[model samples]
Target: MAKITYIEHDGTRHEVEAENGLTVMEAAIRNMVPGIDADCGGACACATCHVYVDEAWLEKTGERASMEESMLDFASDVQDNSRLSCQIKVSDALDGLVVRLPEQQG
Candidate 1:
């Protein structure tokens, strides 16, 4: 399992063990991490699961696909490291991955 840390807009942190192959959004849901509404499950059809990948882990998380980028246009506070949590598959390489939630989901 990979250990992932989720930080909320208010600096609250939730660290949890994520199963390999599960999407980051799934991990958040499993661990009861607040702020990830995951309105579309893992379908990547909505921006409610948006998160900002920590700069140090951005490369390992891979780049956003065109569809994800397009969906992110509806998210609030989009940033260079912004990603749809559902689009980030958890893997061994993603252990210790850190992401922050935006102040609100758009």
Candidate 2:
């Protein structure tokens, strides 16, 4: 499992352990992390699960897919580090992934 940290816009933090095959979005939703609405339930069809991947962990999380990029265009406060959590798969390499939520989802 990987330990993922989800920090809300207000600085609230929720650290969760996610199984290898789960998406970061799944871990947040399963652990009840307040800022990740995950409205489309990991389908990459909405931007509610948008997050800013910690710069330190960006390489491990990998690049956003074309579909994810399209979806991110609909999110609020898009950034160079912005990503759709559902597009990031959990793995041993991402053991300490950290993501920050926006003030509000799109």
Candidate 3:
């Protein structure tokens, strides 16, 4: 399992053990991380699970897919590091990944 950290807009943090093959959105939902709404579940149909990947781990998470990139437009605060958590699959490579949530979901 990968150990991922989710930080809310107000600075609250939640650490969770995310199993490989599950999406980051699923990990957050399972761990009750406060900011990840995941309105479309893990189907990548919504941006409610939007997160800003920490710069240090950006390369490790890889670039967002075109579909994910398009979906990000519906998020509240778009940034170069912004990504849809549901599109990020959990893996050993992402064990120490850290992502920050925006102030609100769109």
Candidate 4:
């Protein structure tokens, strides 16, 4: 299991255990974290699962695929660390990883 920290808009941190091989969005949705709408489920179609991962954790989180990169253009407040949580597979390597939730979604 991996420990993921979800940072809220008000700077609150919520920690939860994430199962390996699960998507970040799946973990968030399963844990009932706020801001991860996942309206399209785990599919790459919707950017509603957008999240900003901590830059320091980027290397461990791995790079985004072209599909994720292309979709981020539609994500609000896209940044260098922005990623679709649905496209990210969790692993023990992701333990202690932290992702910030965006304020809004379209």
Candidate 5:
């Protein structure tokens, strides 16, 4: 299982163990971790699961696709490192991955 650390705006952090092959959004929602709403499930349709990946771990995660990039257009307070959690698939390489939640999600 991959260890996902989710950091909140106030610095409070929640770490959860997630299985491989599951999307980050799915893990967050299933584990009841605060931050990701995943309102559109795992369809990559809604930007509710928007998050900013840790700079050190960005390259460790998979590349973003054109559809995910386009959906980010609806995200609020988007940053250069912003990514939709639903687009991130969990894997052994991402065992210790960390994703910071935005103050406001779309």
Candidate 6:
């Protein structure tokens, strides 16, 4: 399993153990991490699960898919590091992955 950290805009931190094969969005929702609405579940159809991948873990999380990029257009405060958590699949390589939530989801 990968250990993922979800930090709220206010700085609240939630660390969760995500099984390999689960999406980071699923891990956040399962752990009840506030700020990740995951409105469309893991379908990559919405921006409610928007997050800023920690620069240190960006490569490990991989690039956003075309669909994810389209969905991100609906999110606020987009950044170079912005990502749709639902698009990031967990894996041993993603252990200790950290993502920061925006002030509010789209």
Who wins the TM-score comparison? 1
lDDT of 2: 0.93
TM-score of each: 0.98, 0.97, 0.96, 0.95, 0.96, 0.97
Which scores higher on TM-score, 2 or 5?
Answer: 2
Q: By summed lDDT, which 10 consecutive residues of candidate 1 come out lowest?
A: 37-46
What tens digits encode model 2's per-residue C-alpha lDDT throughout 1-106? 9999889998988889999999999989899999889999899999999999999998888888899999999999999999999999999999988999999998
Candidate 3 C-alpha lDDT tens digits along 16-102: 899999999999999899888988887888899999999999998889999998899898879999999998889999999999999
Question: Which scores better on lDDT, 2 or 4?
Answer: 2
For model 4, what is the error of residue 37's alpha carbon versus the real structure, in angstroms, after optimal superposition?
A: 0.3
Prediction 5 TM-score vs. true: 0.96
Q: In every candidate, how many clashes are there? A: 0, 0, 0, 0, 0, 0
Worst 10 residues of 3 by lDDT: 35-44
Worst-scoring 10-residue span by lDDT in model 4:
97-106
**Which is the winner by lDDT between candidate 1 and candidate 6?**
1
Worst 10 residues of 5 by lDDT: 33-42
The candidate with the higher TM-score, 1 or 3, is 1
Per-candidate RMSD, Å = 0.5, 0.6, 0.7, 0.9, 0.8, 0.6
lDDT of each: 0.96, 0.93, 0.91, 0.90, 0.91, 0.92
| Per-residue lDDT over 28-77 for candidate 6, one digit per residue giving the tens place of the 0 to 100 score | 99999999998888788889999999999988888878888899899999
Return the top candidate by lDDT: 1
Clashing pairs in 4: none
lDDT of each residue in 1-106, candidate 1, tens digit only = 8999999999999999999999999999998999999998889899999999999999999999999999999999899999999999999999999999999986
Pairs clashing in candidate 2?
none
Candidate 6, residue 51: CA error in Å?
0.4
lDDT minimum window of 10 residues, candidate 2:
57-66
CA lDDT of 57 in candidate 6?
93
Residue 94, model 4, lDDT: 93
